[model samples]
Target: MKRLRLYFALFFILLAVPIVILLSHTYSNLEQESFFLYRRTAESLMATVYQRLQENLLVEEQRPYTHYRYIHVADRAVPQQEGLNLSPLADFPVQSKIPGILGYFQIDPDGSFHSPLLPDKDPAIAVPQREERQEMKDKLATLLEGLFSLTPGLQAQLDELKLEESPPTAKKNSSNFRDNLESRVDITLEQRYEREASESTYRLGSKEDPKTDSLQRRVQKSSLRQAEIFDSQLKDAYSQDLEKAKESAAPQRADDAPDSRVVAGQTNRAFQMGDELRSQDKDVLSEPEAEPEVVAEVDPFQSEVIDNRWLVFYRKVWPQQRRYIQGFAASLPEFLESHLDAAFLNSALPETASYLVFHQGELLEPTPAGQNNPRPLLLHSAALPYPLNDFDLAITVAQLPQSPAHQLVTFLALFLSVLFLGGFLGVYRLTVKQMELAQKKSDFVSAVSHELKTPLTAIRMYGEVLMEGWVEEEKKEGYYQQIHDESVRLSRLIQNVLTLAELERSEWQINLTTVQPVEFVAQITERLSNQVKRAGFEFETVSEGEVKPIQVDTDALTQILINLIDNAIKFSKDAETKKIVLTASQLGNDCYIRVRDFGPGIPSRKLKSIFEKFYRIDNEMTRTTRGTGIGLSLVKMLADAMGAHVDVANRQPGTEFSLRF
Candidate 1:
């Protein structure tokens, strides 16, 4: 029972060794496969993120307002009204909010815009100032109104003239009146009259003050005439300015010249309208041209929308956005509150609470949340951080299943582990069984040798006594023959038992020496010829090649030859003329020895196991041979010890045993 337990323990250990090795190798391969799977998943996620952002930006770019609404407000002169305020527009709902917009402001009294969010004392507010030249033009027109109001009647007459029909002639007439009025208007009134009868007499004393009265009347008439001319000239000048402003304010037309041209008819009509206003005693500044107010330019690099709420602004945002994305990628949260699928999050985050974020093909760090650290939020550039802007959009990638290669590797590892364990267990059990059988065979051989030795000794002693003339002379002949035959049989049995013992112990030794191949064959034939003839067999010896000395054990060779010749003699039952042939040949550095006999050949299936101990064909001829089965087994063991090989094969009519040394 203890031996059995030991054997079982050894078997399990032997089985476990290879199983452990296989399992370790399998596990390593699985880890590598898993790593590759992770890398592939990361790469795919990055690609998805990049693609989604790009698509969103493209869709956003296609909108009409995106191209038109990128206004830059640089200076802020008033703190209360700056940034992107839409509250001042009464038509806009008070509760309405715009994403990404910071604040708004109107141009201040100091000709600058200011943000209400920023302090009034901020120094960036005081930059280069714009002069507001349009406002100045309005104030100038108000100052000139009284001076131009006097020409109401003349202005009516000028308005009746078709300025658009002949603008050059009207301009010339108006210019002449301007020159005359500039020369005549004065703060002090003086009259100069042409005198006709002055030569007759010196002036009489006491002339009335005609110059004051007549000068006042003439001044009033001149002022009215000059005002009409001034009005017409001012109207023409204002119309020209209006045309220039309209041209400047007009959106760029497809085929318009680099320098835009104004239509002459339009300019003339504008002037005529101004002239009509002058006839009503009103000062008319050129009408401000109507312009389509452009708010901002669409950001082309922005991404498109995936779902309606998400705005993906891929690479289109500012350089700061690039930095933000890089940082965000470096710190992905294990958990996220996004509208993305829950399964995606669960699969992506490992049980160890590890999650990876990738952006644009790069891996990122995760943002940690704790007692002091709040979660860092990612926002679009168009939308400022929370409390500054709002958005209902998010971005995330779905986790994919394990790849086929990974699964295959895992399965292969498991399969190999099982195979290795099973094979080890089988080998271990077989080895133990073989060892136990060998031990039992050894013990049996020891007991059999003891039993056989005593009886054989007693028989040989009695037969020798009879042969030494202790019986009658006629009886002595038969006794001597019987003694010789009995002694031979006993010696064979003893030799077989000893050979078996030596083979079992693996202690069979060979002393190699060089001997002539022909001499060796001759000696063995001469010694075994009598036995063969007695057994009714014809013996032949064949030799080839020069009589060269070959390296071999003479004693072992003698035993091998004796066994083959004896077996051939005993087993050659089918031949009418029983014959045994011993042949020797040399090829290169090796020698070949063959023993052939015209005998009933070994059966095909038994041939393989014929060299095993006690193994023999179960047939009538073999049972009558009276032979122990150790002969061929000894032959094989001796051949192996001598570094030579022996084999048997069926000849055409019999059997052959061949040895290569």
Candidate 2:
């Protein structure tokens, strides 16, 4: 039984091992799958957000990029702010929320624009930019050597204007002006005739200001008029001088002109052939450098994110229907809340999931789980969705909280483990009980055989002596008495065995009758007194009150007392003064008979189990009492069949047995 319990315990533990592993495996898989699903949902949501941003930006598609592109420097007293604001991109609709935007700037067709964002900038930074821009222009001039033929005539044109405008003197002033033109960086023509108040006189005088210098204002106004005339004359004279120079310098045949120099412009009138530039650069080519190729129309409504953070877009605000490139810069976070967040708020995704975006090596907004944790997983990464700003971008989402049903499954798995342990314990206990009973039954058989043999041998010996006439009459009486006592004891053992067998097979019958308690006590004492006296135990009987007649079975009642007395005698062998008491009493409607012995009492732990069939108080391996284990069992079975209850209890230096009717 012990070994079986151990095996069962080990089995259950082994069983739990795989279950725990399975549950853990299942949970890990679910977590991974959930992370995958969240990744997909985040992708869908980001796509929608980007789409909405594009749509919102489209509202200003046709409205021209005039507001984003102007770069005017303050000259004299007035700050010329034609279009450029200090924070030029601050006014763009989608980009307005961001604080860091360099202005929209375009380099001349042959150079690169690398201007920084404008506000009040430090001179140290501006100086570097100026130097870099100058380098870029110099590099561009080298690459477009054929285009230099158009540039050389401009400095000469400015020198001729100052010469023609001066009195037939001031030749040194004209020479200084030509030297300054050569030093100037930007060479684009600015039409002074197109200024807002062109061809107009000054209007500074008012009637209320009677002392104002009207003559002084008139002189200033006349100076401005003369300047405007000078600008107009410069434009017309430069065109004529350029044509005359080309006509005089060129050979008669187109092939005869210097190959290193080509008059670069939109039309072939400046150069006979236009093959110096690559085909891809044609869209950007325009007057003064290269010819403009016919370009396919692009949707002006298009807009896109730049380098994962900036916004690159365009506006066709150029006058005379000329094409140009324009853009704006913005903070990515501000843009998300202002435009993208609403789109995501309306997307269909699990509420337990949250998201973060990472581009290149930088984490944009939201964030990964923590500093120590990478995004749970990765696969669905979307790059910036426009050709203009090609950025490597990705979003990682975490699905953190588990569902209620998932929690329930985990609970059930643990509960099942406990149940398995409980069941193993219960089964082990029952097996132990069975084994104990089996051992007790084997001990009972051996004890019963020993008891029967002792008496049977004595009877056989006395009968043989009497039959052989081996003793005189005086000794014969003692031998016959010994033989008779042995017979009687052997008969009692046989009768008890037969009775127990009958009870076990459900064949025992009860003849119940109304019997007085006094009579019942006398009947039990008469049957047990001889055996008690023979065992050298002091026996006594007592009854309380004039007992009423109680339902009783005389034969079964005698058997119960006889077995109790016999068991007491067997166990009380070591007592100094062996004593047995048979008491009868009446209380309420029941009569009680108690047979007690003064001897070592039954163990308190085993007291309740003392009456089990084939069960003995003596240890099975070292039983010394001369009786089968069934005597008390018979007592209990007969008493139960006769409408009575039997009980046993431990007492000081003794054990007590009782039957109630």
Candidate 3:
């Protein structure tokens, strides 16, 4: 038994080890797979956010410079003036697609401050005409001042503009507005007209601003290098595009025309017709031709983050010899929230992770998750594009979510573990039951052999003594009685064994007959009365309450009664009050026959399993009783075959076996 148990334990361990290892391996793989899937999603979301920012920035970059100022028939100072003019930008709310814009401003090469909100001052214009404009200009300047005061970089830039606008000496007023305006008019109307009429190109920046120290301070070494590289590339691409556009727009050459003479003839005819009309109408006058506009050289825009909360976008413009800085200012937090946060929430990224923006190692405000303690499971970082250069974007996930495949694997593992353990447990229980049954059967064989041998040996000894004439005359009758009782007991034992075999093999046929319950009881008791008396026990019978007739097989019922009586006599033969009660009664719809013995009652906990085949209350090794265990088993089987039920219960002083029909 110990060896068998050891083998079972080893087998269980072998089976469980592989299953546990397999589950562990599967879990590890699933974890890695989930992380990989989340990482890819984070990467995709970051790329999408960057692309959206670039698209919006492209829109801001393409805005024309003319949008910053107001257009007028002439300058705002001379409303009645016949010439066209440009005025300062109005102080009304700025209309822009970008969010959080404060205002727009410009800085001249000499650091003079100029805003689209503030118009150029003129001594000729009346105060009434410029009153409303001056009010808006003052409000805009005050707003700018308040914003700049909070930002160090903005404050410095504003101070530089103020320094540039101030003259070095008192005599410099002669070279101020009036002379500057005249010089601009001479360059545009006189010198430019002459250069154009002479068919000669006037190069931009032919006159350089004498002040170089201030410009150097304003532009950093790295920023200048970047600007030069970017501007050069931009110009080359622009030139290629322009050449392609011009070639597409240029008129076809006469040599290339399919019918050059036809085209020439049509042109001549139109000219002749125009001349005739002009001759007929003497009052007609020719309109003056418009002059070709000269394009200025504008540098790419550059961005500066001020105090980590403000953003300044500025670009340098070189028109002739004078340099101007044109740009706008905005709240950095509002810009990122309006642009990046919305894009992130709308993307697939937020489903599994969050993001943070950092500029020069400083974290930007309005973080997605709004928490900073949790460690990120997956992190992806990328630098922003130009203008927002040096800014870093990080996508983080506090805990990576389980993927569908991982969830599926987990469910399957649980199911498999349950199934495997359940099967193993079932096999273990079945094997234990089989081993127990085998042990019981072995004990039954030894018991039956001893029972048969004792009876046969007694009968043989008495018969041998009578044949040898060795018995005294007075004891001869006692010897005969002894031999007859032993023969009856031996015959009964063989009959019980044979009946049990027939019942197990399904060869035991039951013939049913109707018999009165009282008569049935009387006949069963009469048949077993001698056997009980021989065992030296007093037996009694009782009938009650108009017992009904029962449908049963008399032979099978008789065998059932004999087994019960024999069991009672065997177990209680040594009791202090050796008595048995055979009862017949009608209780409700059923008729019952009971055989009760005055012996130690069966234990309560073992009551239910006592009727099982080969089950005995006493262990075979220490048993003092003299019967095989098959007596009660045979009684239960015979009763069941007759369509009756058997029940066992403990009486006050003994055990009762009932057969209900």
Candidate 4:
């Protein structure tokens, strides 16, 4: 049994380790999946905002340079000199389309400031001069001043710009532009145009965020987001015609300076600028005029945050060999409310999640929701794509949402664990019981062999001595008597063994008959008195009250009484008062027969187990009692077979075995 228990413990430990690991691994996967799903949703929403900004920027990049000034046509004919010279600063539709646009400004390389709200430069044009335009300019100046006051670093940069002959980024941007133009010189006009258009579109370069990269890879593999596919095949004929057109139509530049008249003529052909400004301005040049040669190139917009509270986006356009900075500034609060807040509100992210905006590494305000929480859990962080590369975005959640299968997996793990533990416990207990029963059977066999050998040896020796005629007449009678007693004892032992075997095989049947208590007691005493006397135990039978009749099998009940009396005689033989009492009593509709011995009583805890087959309180090899351990077990089985119940109890000086019906 001990060895079996050790094996069960080892097995349980080995199995439990993997079970625990499996459950833990499952839980970890569920947690990771939940976080991954949340982060993907947040990133998708951010990408939507990015795409919107990119589209807007693309539109701004495509703005015609001539749109900044007004032109006049004379006599409904083309003449470069007939156009009006208006201020390049004029209100445009881009101000209304973009959110939180304070105003647009163009800064000359010579440090001259110009606003779109400024009136026409040429006074010959009869256009109304509104006071609000001046107010708008003043407002823009105040906005810049307030923003510069808060941002010392940007203010210093602006002061440096005033001292420098050219902006710090001009050389690199100019070199890139020149390289692009030179590379396209050999291409066909149509092919060059197509390639230029493609190059003008910004690439959202890969950002270094381990989590986002991992999630993006997973998202792509899952095909959760579909990507656009474009055709790569080109027309060879179109390319040949475009190449001829580029060489024939291309004009030469004079003195390394571009003529705005020629550029405007080229631009007007596409945009119809002369028609737009003809009715508004009348001071137009009558003929072509000579102006100093100039070169021009425009760079993409760049964005920055000032004092974590303002966003400024600007672009550099070079014309006439001089750089011009054109851009707008807006307050961060309005920007967030217009772009970030709107996107967040429309996003599918959970309510517990928060979107945080950061300038450089510093956090920006209008504080995001849940930012002030005691411990905000961060889910994903990523840098915005250019022109907003200076900013970063972080998503946090007060509490992450659980995975859809979390509950199911948890319950399944728990149920499996419980089932496994229960099975192990049940099997272990059953194994213990079986092992104990095997040991008991072994002891029973050894005890039975000893018991049979003792009596059989005595009977055989006595018969052999008598048949040899070696004893005198009187002594021979004594020897013969010994043989008779030993034979009877051996016969009774054999009968009990056979009865137990029959009961074990479930082949025993009972014939229950109604019998009076007095008659039953008389029958029991007559059958068991001689056996008890022979064993030197005084036997007595008593009836109490008006003992009621009981429904019992008479032969079975007699056998039960004989086993009990025999047990009492064997157990009480060593007592000072060796007495066995058979008592019959009536209580309401029940009749009880109790056989009690005045000897050492059974221990309270062991009393119930005394009826178990082959169970002995004393060690089998060390016991002095002359009886098998199955007597009480047989008694209980007979009682139960007869529709009666049997139990044992400790008496004042001994133990009582009760049979109730």
Candidate 5:
């Protein structure tokens, strides 16, 4: 049993040790593989966003770039023209090549700066002058007679409507809307031209008289103020024309009935509808739905969007036609959504996944769910580089194939645990059985050797005494009888051993015969009475239950009883009142034979192991009785071959060994 246990321990150790190591390595590789994939995704995503963002920035901002170089246009100071007091004109090749440089100016010997684009004017920022006020007024009259019209589309549409196209030819006639718009625009320009003529009259008067400097200054100031007022008036007239056109095209029910002779009214209305459609601006620019809340305080360098005002850019050194540097004051949320929302929505991620982008301290996220979702368990993030280096984006994901490495590692660990455990249990059972068989075989060899030698030594000793004639004639017969008895004992011991060997090999069989129980017991007791008395053990044969005839193999039954009686005598030899009983009875269809003894009882724990081959009760020390351990073992084998069941129990004073056949 101990050897069997050791085999089991060894098998389990073999099965488990290697599997643990294999799983450890598998998990390590899984982690490395997962990390590699994550890093790979992050690196490629950053690179792609970097390239795209750089392009967007350059295309949108059109930033100023500068380069410096020392250009010597001349090796020596050039002589100035003695007659010319004005500065050199702006015709520099270098200035044209440089970005945003409007023009160049050089200081003349008279300390006056000049550029070709800014050539001399009589008075700066003043309107052009005309001498013939009457002739100009006549040209205006020619223009008003229809030489030109700025609002061609509105005028044509209003002509088809025939609602109010012009002022009436008669006092009672309805007005014409087209004529009214034209007169208003033309009259404003004519009025400004009239003011220009008046200013020119003052300049002409000042030029004729050399000492009218004061009068010239006053005239220039008055002309400048009048010019500003005229510009305002012209702008207002144009705006009014635009507003009138829009109002006329607004959706409303026509006042004139279709059949009431309304100047082919349907066709005219259709043409006007087409005109209105063609006049609308096609470029659709988005505006914020709601204005951003105003703060109590303002921050410098951070401006808000303004209505109807554009942030325009112009050449750096231009003639003040536009501002040099200006930023488009955009509503942050609306602008970003218009540009970036669709891109993220149509990306490789699933519809359920979320994408969030934060740039320049502002955040943009898609709301496909109509509301923002909570942060999910799995998320991948990457930072943008170059133009968008301060920006980052994250994707909250749900379907990532089980985190590739995590799935692999978990599967491997589960598979290995089951495989190793099954292997350990299977191999352990086989190994344990093998070990038990080997242990029993070794004990059998030692026991057989001891038993065979015991009877042979005694038989040879008495025979030699008779051969040597070492005894008187009176004792010679006793010696001869002793030799015969010893010979019989040796023969029976050899027969039992051979029978047990044949039984183990499955080569032994029994032939049963019907015999009277009383006769059966008497025949067996007659043979074993003298032999047991010589060993100082009293023996008896008894019957129980119904004394019916029993099926018995005569010779095998005799051997079976011999072994059982012998085992009882051997174990009970040291008892205070040594005795053995062989019992035979018929109960139902089976025969019961019991061999009982009055001796020290068997221990409860060792009872089951007593019938095993080469097993004995006196396992701790050699016994005083002369016997091998195979006596009871042979009895058990013979009983089983005869289709009998053997059982044992602790008797009141000793032990009970019984068989049911």
Candidate 6:
């Protein structure tokens, strides 16, 4: 049974150690997995956000310029003459007879390009001089009258051509009567012709007052054909100038310098001057002038060259603009609303969902507009870089539900494994101790049986011999004595075995008697004295402290003392001075009896187990000693039954066994 228990304990211990080690490793892996998942989710979310931003920017870039029709231009317009200051232009009516012309112009002539005109504001108006205004009014009336006088068929043709052609009737009404008097109706035709010739010469750059000459020639021209041709050319030139102005008002190229051009609806004064210069070659010049007229290049398209305005909306803006952009971005929330859940889904681990956006390197911190008027988070299929030029952004979203419980389970598993291992080890150590004790008991039992059988066999043999009359009468007496001693030893062994068995079964009861300590010691000494003397040992007894009687079983007390004395005597057989001493003393309410032997003492290693069942000091002296080994074990049990303690200690010369009752 002891061997089976030892094997069972060893098997359990072997299993428990590995289980504890495995549990610890599993717990560590769980923690690492949690962290890895979090990092991966964060990175994925960042990529999604960056892609959305990039897509939005691309869409805005693809939008056409015609959709945003309002032109942004400079605020000031320069005049034709160097010192001539001009007021800002009036707001022109956007509704025009022409279907596509939305009449508005930005005129910044001085080229101070700071302020931009918003599309919402009216076109600037310039204050004109009264004389210039009257002149403009007369010219406009003449042009309107001519337009109205055209025949319906001609007007249809003109409309088809989309040409602003002046009618002949209006020109004929403005002609002079000098050419009509040619049919023998002119008495001073020569004088009139010479005056007309002189005025033409003056008009043709003869250095004689060109303004007066031009006015005279206009009054002198009586032919309706000449007047019609001049009016038609002037109107064509004026219309062409307007078209050029409109073209110039559009956005310019990147490298163009700002220069003045004829304002829309303004008279082409430069064209008029050039026309008068050209007339000098038509029999109108009397002499060539030393200097030629300086004709400026009149590109009406130059003023229309508009530069594009690049507005970058950063985090901060004017309150109005800030409010506008915020509202604009806010309006997109519904478009992006469905993507929030998708972001969570994309996270590989639940706890990682919270850190998802942070891992996306392209995601940026929320701008003021984004914060104040947030848009729903949107996910995109591709990744792009965030436009955070200065600082990095780290954002945390909702908490993730990682399986902490699972991790906890791992920890608990490890803890349980360790506990199981410890339990197994404890059971194994206890089993080993129990098995050792059992083996000793078995050996003791076998030895005791052999020892008992030897004495009993001797007694039986002697009886048988006596029955056979195999010895002399004197020899028979000696044989009977030997038989008597053997019988006593056999009886003692049987009594020890019975007492031990009772103690094991928890049935041993102490029958108390008030026995004097000194008497008890002396009686045990006298009983063991014959054996001690035969073994060449001296026996002595000492009593101290007015030795009082102790309450104990007389037989049990005597047995305990006798066993200790016998053991001492046996072990002291080869000692130089073989002496056994029995002593008793009164200590408070207890009595102590000590048996001392001047013999080889018990070994130090065997001292602790000396009182255990069948435990013997493993030495040559003890091996040779005739003992069942259960004697001291029985002594301990009997002492315990009497409420006494049995202890042994090595003296300087030998060993001492003491019992306190």
For this target, which candidate reaches the highest TM-score against the unseen true structure? 3
lDDT for 245 (candidate 5): 36
TM-scores of the models, in the order given: 0.44, 0.53, 0.65, 0.62, 0.46, 0.48
1-661 per-residue lDDT for model 6 (tens digits):
6676767767776876677577656754553354334434544565564445445443432221111212211122234432111112222222222122222221111111111112212122112232343343343233323222322234234334321322111011112222321221222322433443344321111132221222210111112222222223223444443344334454433234122232322223323343455567787468865432211111101011011111121110111111000000111122222233444455553432221121122332332222321222111111113221111222232332346766677668868767876887787778777877777877776687679789989999999999999998889988987898888888888888888888899988778988777776777777777777766888888888887777988888877877887788778888898888888888787777888988878788888888877776763234766777788888888888888898999998899998887
lDDT score, candidate 1, position 424: 63
TM-score of 6: 0.48
Name the better of 2 and 3 by TM-score.
3
lDDT of 4: 0.62
Q: After superposition, how far is residue 131 of candidate 3 from its true place, in Å?
A: 13
Backbone-clash count (model 6): 22
Candidate 3 lDDT score at position 563: 82
lDDT tens digits by residue: candidate 1, 421-525: 678678766876777557545644654565467557767776767757578877776666556656775776678678768867876677899988888899888
- What candidate 2 gets wrong by more than 4 Å, as runs, is 1-64, 67-352, 355-436, 470-478, 544-552, 585-592, 639-644
| Clash count, one per candidate | 34, 2, 2, 6, 7, 22
How much RMSD separates candidate 1 from the native structure?
Answer: 31.1
**Candidate 6 local distance difference test against the native:** 0.47
Cα misplacement distance, residue 382 of candidate 2 (Å): 8.0
lDDT of 3 by residue, 80-177 (tens): 32222333233346555567876677654444455655333212211222454455555445544543332223534543444244211211111233
lDDT of each: 0.45, 0.52, 0.62, 0.62, 0.48, 0.47
Clashing pairs in 2: 102-117, 306-310
Question: Sort by TM-score, best first: what order?
Answer: 3, 4, 2, 6, 5, 1
Between candidates 3 and 4, which one is better according to TM-score? Answer: 3
Model 6 residue runs over 4 Å out of place are: 1-407, 426-438, 457-480, 587-590, 619-622
Off by over 4 Å in 3: 61-93, 99-334, 337-415, 469-474
